[model samples]
Target chain A: MSTTKKAHTTPPYELIYWPTIPGRGEFIRLVFEATGTPYTDIANETKDGISAVLALKDETATTSGDGNPPAFAPPALKIPGQGKDGKALVIYQTPSILAYLGNKLNFAGTDEAEKHYILSHTLTALDLNNETHDTHHPIASQLYYEDQKPEALRKATDFRESRLPKFFGFFERVLKGNEEGGGKFLVGGKLSYADTTLWHVLDGLKFAFPKELAAREKEFPALFGSFYGSVKEVSGLKEYLASDRRLQYSQGVFRYYPELDRQ
Target chain B: MSTTKKAHTTPPYELIYWPTIPGRGEFIRLVFEATGTPYTDIANETKDGISAVLALKDETATTSGDGNPPAFAPPALKIPGQGKDGKALVIYQTPSILAYLGNKLNFAGTDEAEKHYILSHTLTALDLNNETHDTHHPIASQLYYEDQKPEALRKATDFRESRLPKFFGFFERVLKGNEEGGGKFLVGGKLSYADTTLWHVLDGLKFAFPKELAAREKEFPALFGSFYGSVKEVSGLKEYLASDRRLQYSQGVFRYYPELDRQ
Candidate 1:
């Protein structure tokens, strides 16, 4: 309803994500920030914005539903427009939400080939996201991070050495492939969600394994440079970072566990 | 290229997966089977089908071309007649490929909501798949299952006790929500990719942890039953499972490490 209640209605999307952690929602939030689109971020909705999400979930938890339920999980998006029966429209899953937004925002590749390219890249970044989360919580998410600290140490070290290099290598290839656009962004002539995601991934790694990232930063100069430079320069992203909305890396997906960061 | 040669090309898509080892590709292979689509098993490309996978990775690693790189590690799809510039289309990442095929085959949901719902469920199955893989390769994918036996045992114990119940519980809720279609499918009135994925997840778990699965099977009777019933009745899957293309569980993502499986 925040998206609907707003006076200036250029953007009409409601995002329901955990207020305490940026986690998955940061990807979608970055896209909106980059595009300068207005979307209501219902952070920590239990006190404020979660009621809508809970209601939506309860309504769809049945068989006789008229429409499709969100496939699963958080980072759901809702367009305030009404349906045939005059209700809201919603979609979930970060990839699906990004795809829908890419389609809406025109960053999702212009042609079929481009769409495929965007989709493929999006999925690739998603893999990195999952792996990043698994680095700390490799054993289980329900269990506390402390409970799995030993496994986390081994996993994080491997992630810093093997996984980081591999991912940085992949993104470096993507950046190098951008020869069509003077070799700046990942796709086309301008920035896409892929670029934003790369920035997030790099930022997360830097926070989690600052020493490793600092040591290995020179290896992926192109990707690392573009990531650092873009985050600093992107006006909206700069603002988001400076603002309180961008949650600090704490107990979220990518945590800075010094013990786990050792070589 | 095989798809191009099809005369009565109504034959389903061409799935290029390892001839041996169910691995990640089985997710897509199962859907094609469930939907009764005709697809060629390119398992014979190499001496034992794994070389073919290696060749694909080689292309991913060394090949430099224009367009986004392949997503995820494996289980790429070659859709017939949809390739760009007369080339056979290739899409990677098991979940994305399954969702793409599900959409094309009409096994995905009817609308956006249904599509998200199916994706979420499939993703949870994928999470389960990841845990199964970690049971064998806990330290790193670069290390062989045998090399990581000690780590695998530690990881698997936690997986069986904690992770299994979480994923299984999610599936149970999904199945229980099937009030219109009975508690047999994961989504909507008909079978979706989630159901097939659930089948494969349960099947792989049963194969890898027969003793553990058998002990807990009765506790999740509906989920266990849905796994068997869905795959048995699925059209092409039944044929595929019986054929040579259906690889064994050895050396794949989900391996039978007895030490890890034992209580």
Candidate 2:
């Protein structure tokens, strides 16, 4: 396949996220990587990047103008304008950003039904992501994980026993039902943004709850092995995952709190 | 405006949700109400509705076939087929369902950017909804509100003091920045599904945290009053709210736990 020059020719898309953790930004990064889209990860690039990321949340910031609404949180994207007078559009909300990218990148599905299907899966992945994050911060996001450890243990148990199996089973069903794709991709036969999202969800689960996920691995052979294997084999994604850019899982959304994990 | 015959003329949409609480189903309900779309809240109608709702989660169920995937949770919509051979499309995820309804009901936006803007706002509303839900169930959804009351109190404090104000401010900014609608609606000048969602959010907040919300009511004049007032004035919605069909809020996503609330 010939490489698309759009990444090089067009102004680089700017992503504003926290400097340390991969967090929700990883989902967007996966999309950009899978599609071979060239973009600048702003917070990782400069010493003042965190300040720039926080400024978008500042109501008094200059970037808040030019008909743009202030982003509620990070992982905000700044896509270059089409014309001279057109200013960059800044939008937040992870699912919304992914949908915007999916539309622009043609990874969102082909028809309306397919698009909604992809969306449903993406939102489900996000739900799983939020639940995983809460496993570590069950009380409050502002509170220290140490302070909330007891509640986190309780929350993590329900998450692993109930939520994980439920979500994984749902994805497996989606993969199996995709007759158009022959059970390969999440949506149409072709790989879309939802596949990348599921891949991340599976990856995060494995990282956070290694023994528990491993125990259930045989339960979702298609989701854990085949579907996940396919996403990992995506040429560009394979390379990106191996690169230094793939931030290690730490105190981010999917933290490996050993006390919270179970067999 | 003439009442669109789409409600009665078309096959009624079947909504599969919990029979009791409004929960996330209310968001979808508001869309149908605003557009005058006829839908059967299945769980509320038949004695076997709860069984039917749970059957969707059963992997071995026959209805899971015929090209429909199992729903991850309730508030799943089963739209009647368009053609003789067409199968009823089953979709879940509140945002996705709302998007599907917005497209059919003409509440989504006129252009691509407008559609995305609406989506971004809707997702943010959902975030607020989730946070609000978490205030009552800070530890685990599986646990009763009473079981988590202490942690719930702590979580509710951060939510009311920090998260609620932040989200309300974001909505106000979105309303203020909408040049197309002149701040009358969330996206365009005319009422959309998102406007209904924002109205519900404000209403739920008031119901759950009356004192705190009332104290901050003047802080978000556009969101709390003007925009909300306009949404209430929407002819169809006005009638729907007055009708018994509008489920009273209790022990749902937004609940009135007096001990959890503060000024």
CAPRI rating of model 1: acceptable
Clashing pairs in 2: A181-A189, B181-B189
RMSD values for the candidates in order, in angstroms, are 4.0, 2.9
TM-scores of the candidates are: 0.86, 0.92
Off by over 4 Å in 2: A1-3, A8-11, A46-51, A60-63, A82-85, A179-183, B1-3, B7-11, B45-51, B59-65, B82-85, B179-183
Evaluate candidate 2 by giving its C-alpha RMSD to the native, one decimal: 2.9
Q: Give the TM-score of candidate 2.
A: 0.92
Off by over 4 Å in 1: A1-11, A50-72, A80-86, B1-14, B43-52, B59-72, B79-84
TM-score of 1: 0.86
Quality class of the docking in candidate 2, CAPRI style: medium
Chain B TM-score, all predictions listed: 0.85, 0.93
Native interface contact recovery, model 1: 0.26
